[model samples]
Target: MKVAIVGAGLTGSLLACFLARRGLTVTLYERRPDPRVAQVERGRSINLAISERGLNALRKIGLVDEVMADALPMKGRMIHPVTGALDFQAYSASGDRAINSISRGALNNALLTAAVAADGVSVEFEHRLVELDSAVGRMVFATPAGKVSVEADVVLGADGAGSAVREQLLAEGIVAENVDFLDYGYKELSIPAVDGEFALDPGALHIWPRGTSMMIALPNPDKSFTCTLFWPAGSFDALTSASGIEDHFRINYPDLLPLAPNLVDDYLNNPVGVLGTVHTLPWQAHGRTALLGDAAHAIVPFYGQGANCAFEDVVELDRCLDDTGGSWARALPLFEARRRENTEAIAEMALANFVEMRDKVASPVFRLQKQIEHTLERLLPGTYVSRYELVSFSTTPYAEVQHRVHRQHQLLGAAAVAAAGVLFAVTRSRARR
Candidate 1:
C-alpha cells in the first residue's frame, strides 16, 4: 500500500518507520526544512521527559538504545521553595525507577534519520501540505520548486497541534476540532554548566514552584539545563525592561536568577509559547486518512506525556494493523476506538498535574499525602501503586490508570474513617470504666 504521512516530526517520522517495516511504501511530508541541516527554531523546543511508555514504543522498533543514548534519568522532582531548604520527592517508592530526560530536537532528528533509512520509506523536506482529498486519496503540496501533487492509498496526519491536514479535513467537513487555549504561556531559558560541570543536581527534575506560576529545569546531555517558565499569558509581556525582569526573578525566583546567567536576555528575547488542549471528533476519516499524536489530541505538557503519548499512538496504530492483517479499512477505525478514551483521560490528568506542579508540589499537605501514598505502595506491594508510578513506570493504559487511582483513593479514605471510629469508641469505653 502507498501511504502519505503529513508532518515529518517525531510521530510522523516514527510512524513512517513502522509502516515501512510492514513492507508498505511510505512518504513523509514536512513543512519545515530538515533539522539536521538547519538550526532549531528558538523558544519552542521544550525538553521531553521520556518514560516507560515512550521507551517501550522505541524498543519495539529496536531504536531504544540509539534514541536514549544521551538521555539523563531523573529519579524525582526537586522542589525549590522560596524560603527554605530544598525538598526531593521520589517518583517511585523504591526510589530506583526514573524518567529519562532527552532533548526534543535530538530525538526527532534520530527518528527522522531512522525513517529515512527504513526500506520503502522516503521523506520530502520543505514540502508543505496545502490541500488533501481524503475521499480520493489526493494531496497537493506547496514546495519551493513549485506546486507538487501526490496520490496515495492512505494519508495520516501527525503534523502536530496546528496540523494543516487537520485543517483541510475541517474545511472539507470530514472532521470537527476544538482547541482550548490555556491562559498561561511558557518561555524557554537556559542554565549553562558551571566550571565545566552541571550547575544543579543532574539526577532530578528541578522545579521552582510559585503559587500561581512555576519554573522547571531538566538536565541536558551537554552538562547544561533547559529551564521553562510557565506564567500567566500577560505576565510574559509585562516585563519589558531589564530591571523589571530582574526584579520579578529576585522576588519570585531568587536562586534561579544567579544560576541563569542570560536570564534577562532570554526573558526579553524568547517568545512565549501557548499551552492548550486540542480535542477532535473521530480521529480518522473514511478509513483512508487519519490523525495521530498532537494532531489528533494535543494535551498540555504538565504530565510530561505529550511526546510519550504520541509515541504510544504510533505503537497502537501499528498493533491495529497487525490485528487486522494490514487492512487500512479495519485498522483506522479500530485505532480511533482504542485510543479515544485513553487520550481523553490523559488530557484531563495532564491539566490537573499542572496545578500540582505549580501550586501543590511545595505544600506541606501535598507532601504528606505523597508520603502516605508511598507508604501504602510499600505496604501493599502489588495491590497498591501511586498514580505517578502507574503513569510513568508502567505500560498501563491511561484510562485504566485513572480508574485504579480513583479506587485506591476511595479505599484509603474509608480506612481513615474506620480508624477514627475505633479510636473514638476506645476513648469512650475507657472513660466510662
Candidate 2:
C-alpha cells in the first residue's frame, strides 16, 4: 500500500519508518523547511525528557543507542526553592531508572534520517497539507511549485497539534474535535552555562516552584539549561516596564533573577505557548485515513508525557496492525477504541500533576507527606508504587495506572489509621500511670 504521512516531526517520521519497514511505500509531507538546514525555531523549548515509553519506540528500529548517545540522564527532580537548599526527590531508590534529557530537534532529525534511510520512505519538505479526501484516500498539498494532489491507499495524520488532517476530517463530517485550554500558559527562558560549566546539577530536572507560577530547567548537551516559566495568561503584561519585569521575577523566583543574565531580553522576545487538551471522537475516517499522535490527541506537557505518549502511539498502532494482519479497516477502529480511554485518563492526570508541581511542592506539609509515601513504597515492595513510576515505568496502560494508584493509596490509608489507634492506646496507658 502507498501511505502518506503528514508532519515530519517525531511521530510522523517514526511512523513513516515503521510503515516503510513493512514494505509499504510512504511519502512524508512536512510544512516546515528541512529542520536540519533551517535555523531552529526560536522561542520553542529545545529539549525533552524521554522515558521508557518513548525509548521503546526508538528501539524498534535499532536507533536507541544512537539516540541515547547525547542524552543527559536526569535521575530525579531537583527542586530549587526561592531560598534555602535544593531538595532532590529521587526517582529511583537504586538510582537505576532515569529520564534522558535530549534535544527535541536532534531526536526529530535522527528520526527523519532513519526514515529517509529506509527503503521505501520519501519526504517532501515545504509542502503544506491543504485538504484530504478520506473516502478516496487522497491528500492535497500546496507545494512551493503548485497545488498537488497525491493519491494513496492509506494516509496517516501524524501531524502535531492544530493538524490540517484533523481539521479536514472535521470538515468532512468524519470526526469531532474539541479543545479544552488551560488558564495557565508557558514562556521560554534560558540559563546559559556559567564559565562553560553547568550552573546547577546536571543530573536532575530543576524546578523553582512558586505558588501561582513556576520555573523549570532541563539540561541540554551544551552545558546550558532551558528554563520554562509558567504563569496565568496576560499576567506577564503586568511586568511590561523594566522595573516590573525585574520585580516580578524577584518576588516569585528570586534565585532565578541572579542566574538568568539575559532574563529581560528573553522575557521580551520569547513566545508564550498555550496549553490545551484535545478531545476527538473516532480517530479513523472510514478506515482509509486515520489520525495518530497529536493529530488525534494534543495534551498539556505537565507530566512531561506529551512527546513520550505520542511516540507510544506509533508503537501501539504498529502492534494493532500486527495483530489485525495489516488490514487498516479493522486495525484503525480497534486502535482508537483501545487507546481513547488511556489517553483521556493521562490528560486528566497530567493537569493534576501541574498543580502538584507548581503549588504543592513548596508546602512543607506536602513534602512530609511525600516522604511518608516514599517510605511506604520502599517497605512494601510489590504492594506499593508511586503514581509517577506507574505512569512512566510500567507498560501498563494509563487507565490501569490510575486504578493501581488509587488502590495503593487506599492500602496506605488503612495502615496509617491502624498505627494511629496503637499510638492512642499507648498514650492513654502512659497518662493513667
Specify the highest-TM-score model's number: 1
TM-score of 2: 0.96
TM-score to true structure, per model: 0.99, 0.96
Q: How many backbone clashes does candidate 2 have?
A: 0
Please list all clashing residue pairs in model 1, or write none if there are none: none
Mark the regions of model 2 whose C-alpha exceeds 4 Å error after superposition. Answer: 425-433
Model 1 quality (TM-score): 0.99
lDDT for each residue of candidate 2 in 87-179, tens digit (9 for 90 to 100)? 987776455678989999999999999999999899999999998998998888998899998898888998888999999999999899999
| Distance from true location, Cα of 248 in model 2, Å | 2.1
Best by lDDT: 1
Tens-place lDDT per residue, model 1, 151-249, is: 999999999999898899999998899999999999999999999999999999999999899999999999999999999998888889999999988
